[model samples]
Target: MPVIRPRRLRQTPAFRAIARQTRVHPNELILPAFVREGIGAPVEISSMPGVVQHTLDSLRRAAVDAADAGVGGIMLFGVPAVRDAMGTGATDPDGILNVATAAVVAEVGDALVVQTDLCLDEFTDHGHCGVLDARGHVDNDATLERYADMAIAQAEAGSRLVGMSGMMDGQVAVAREALDAAGHQGIAILAYSAKYASAFYGPFREAVDSQLQGDRRTYQLDPANGREGLREAALDLAEGADVVMVKPAMPYLDVLAGVAASSPVPVWAYQVSGEYAMLEAAARNGWIDRDAAIAEAVLGIRRAGADAVLTYHATELALALRG
Candidate 1:
């Protein structure tokens, strides 16, 4: 009797919709955008088909679009025109990221959360997430000081959330302390708690024009270690992370699920550059249905217990969801 029964719900779209256990809402999706300094027009990332490094004007327009489409937030990553050993741009009040943050906040102030990427990779000449020591290794404690300064600058720029993606120890605590000291007690920290040193970041390197000569295995978690991800989340949580994220989420769904299960704060997953590129490449080659694959990918992350998702497809998907 059961052999014939399963097909009943599968037979109609309406029935399937009603039976669906997981859904991605526009309000649960955050768009990560890149705004490059010195660009008069938006430039497309060759590795990531639909994603672009925006000009100031385009960034404002994009923020407006994201807000109008009901996206919950937009995370801004700045591509500076120059890079320095100390990543001075990251802490500058008029830095590209800060300016973009101010522009976005002004464009859509209360409509959506404007977030900033509080990492040094895009500003550092070496393309490392932190300052390097005399020995050429990333200096952890020294980097935290930079992050603390960067957080206040972002808060001053009107960012509601500062995303700490540098994978440095005690970053959340340092940033929180600095922000509170500067009278920005309301700004929140979103820690990239379980980010792995994944090959999946290749496309992102291109998107940011990375100058990294070596891998970030020293700071980023190893892809093979699931338990370490949980440990990182716990550490970040204790350090005052308002939200914790798992990066390159598709390959780390198990880690994401584990964190989501135990985390007291909101848990987010990033469908990063490579994930976006893979789907776009496949769709371009007629190997997959773009919309269906995107919907499924995001739904899987949501089903894995992500409270929110950072995706390159956020705006388009949000518009589609509305229809």
Candidate 2:
């Protein structure tokens, strides 16, 4: 050991900071927001402590805040006053979500990437994503038609990105064709290509007032099957998805890695509501250090090959990192 100088750079904060391979920035964090119809005031989600079902006014304010903070984007999901067989409220120009989309666009303009959840579950009375067949089972083909219409409506309302989250067969292709035919060529699709049938979506049920009677196994991928997720991502990409995503990101890091490894489009991950709530609850009770745990959650996702993360804690995390 003739003066190897192994400690040359270990003595300085600047030196250690310079060694960061993966960084989480405001631009790398996408915030997911929810809005409700006919709500006079903001309603906090019990399960997701810090999250709220914002009124139209509050939703706009949050959107503006996120945009002002330079967050990558704001992903909006609407909770309508009505639900029906066709999820009619979802495509209505005056529907809560569609209205919120326009409001966000008006508020943020191009300062941020305004995105909307292009799914019927939040609007459907029966909690299915599409029209039920004669047997009452979800009809995948019929669902695609509805998704196509949703894509157009969201784009028309000035949403730059439509998240195809219904897990319907051929949804991305159908939406793409519909958008092109309707002359919405610039609208992008963020396909939730590998959304799983997981317990993590439970808290989301309360967030959206979902009336789901049964599981989404008919469409959503099974959690036990990792290879199937790859197939689904492949299908979404071939169908013209501008980006592909894996839901419940932490539980499926391997799937996230696999999708990112081969996806030509950017691969994103959603740290779903349950994941967020659990961490928050634990940190609240002093089971873990809140800031450190939050940082680890995000860092783990980024390390798993996600180009971007859709997180509920996006704004705070960005601020924490900035400090």
Candidate 3:
């Protein structure tokens, strides 16, 4: 005699299927792609078994497949052959990420949204998000200038949405003003509003070939705090973020939900490489069913009110969900 009668939907598979309000679709998935400089084949990351660091050719092929699967978008990151103190490569029109973005846009055209990472870590030898000051700390204002330049570069290279993942103060305003002043007002900004400093990014370091001298504790959100996440999102919204994101989606579902509930624009969540690898490793160990786990994780994010999810297993999950 339960007041809610929750068992009504559990009567049968057909009933559960028919009554389901939450669903996973290919158009809700966004694949994270990596393009390295002058590589011939895909290089697998040890921490993430099935994921790879893609060469241009491989990246193009994978993008084609994802587009064919009807994914919502592709998020691009670069691994440059050279790095410097200010991450100068990031702002170069001919840089690895910019060139790759152009290439992917040519390959996919209007089929999917092509997003570019507007950050410095992949281009800096020191692996910080910006130029180091006299004391070797990341200079926020200098970094903002660099981000503005990178925003222009990304827009010029055919990126539809620029992913601002550095968690820098005033990044959105800086980049927005830069892009607008350059007459690239069509370009959108997807801010990593609540990116936390967590152990979850360990695999991404390997994926990006990072040479970071220190942690991102100063810029990224503290994992111990949840209210700070909302504050960051608030700042990003006030600064013209077209979309706001919460990184490492699983551990931050509440944050995602809170942000989505309050956000005026779309909310996205990233299933970081470490999250992908952990689930994959557990599946490989015969501890959990891979497909089920992937679907469940994705569904959980959807339930958390994410408009879209950036995931390493985006293609596979899309295929499975479609079937």
> Model 3, range 142-220, lDDT digits (tens) per residue?
8898899999999999999999998889999999999999999999999999999989999999999999977999999
Higher-scoring candidate on TM-score, 2 or 3: 3
Minimal lDDT window, size 10, model 2 = 1-10
lDDT (CA) for every model shown?
A: 0.94, 0.91, 0.93
Question: Residue 143 in model 1: shift from native, Å?
Answer: 0.5
Which ranking of candidates, highest lDDT first? 1, 3, 2
Give the poorly placed runs of model 1, Cα more than 4 Å off: 1-4
Error of 1 at 91 (Å): 1.0
At residue 177, candidate 3 shows an lDDT of 99
RMSD of each: 1.2, 1.8, 1.1
Clashing pairs in 2: none
Q: Estimate each model's TM-score.
A: 0.98, 0.96, 0.98
lDDT of 1 by residue, 195-297 (tens): 9999989999988899999899999999999999999999999999999999989999999999999999999999999999999999999999999999999
List pairs with backbone clashes in candidate 3: none
User: Which pairs, if any, clash in model 1?
Assistant: none
Pick the lDDT winner: 1
* Better structure of 1 and 2 per lDDT: 1
Which ten-residue region of model 3 has the weakest summed lDDT?
1-10
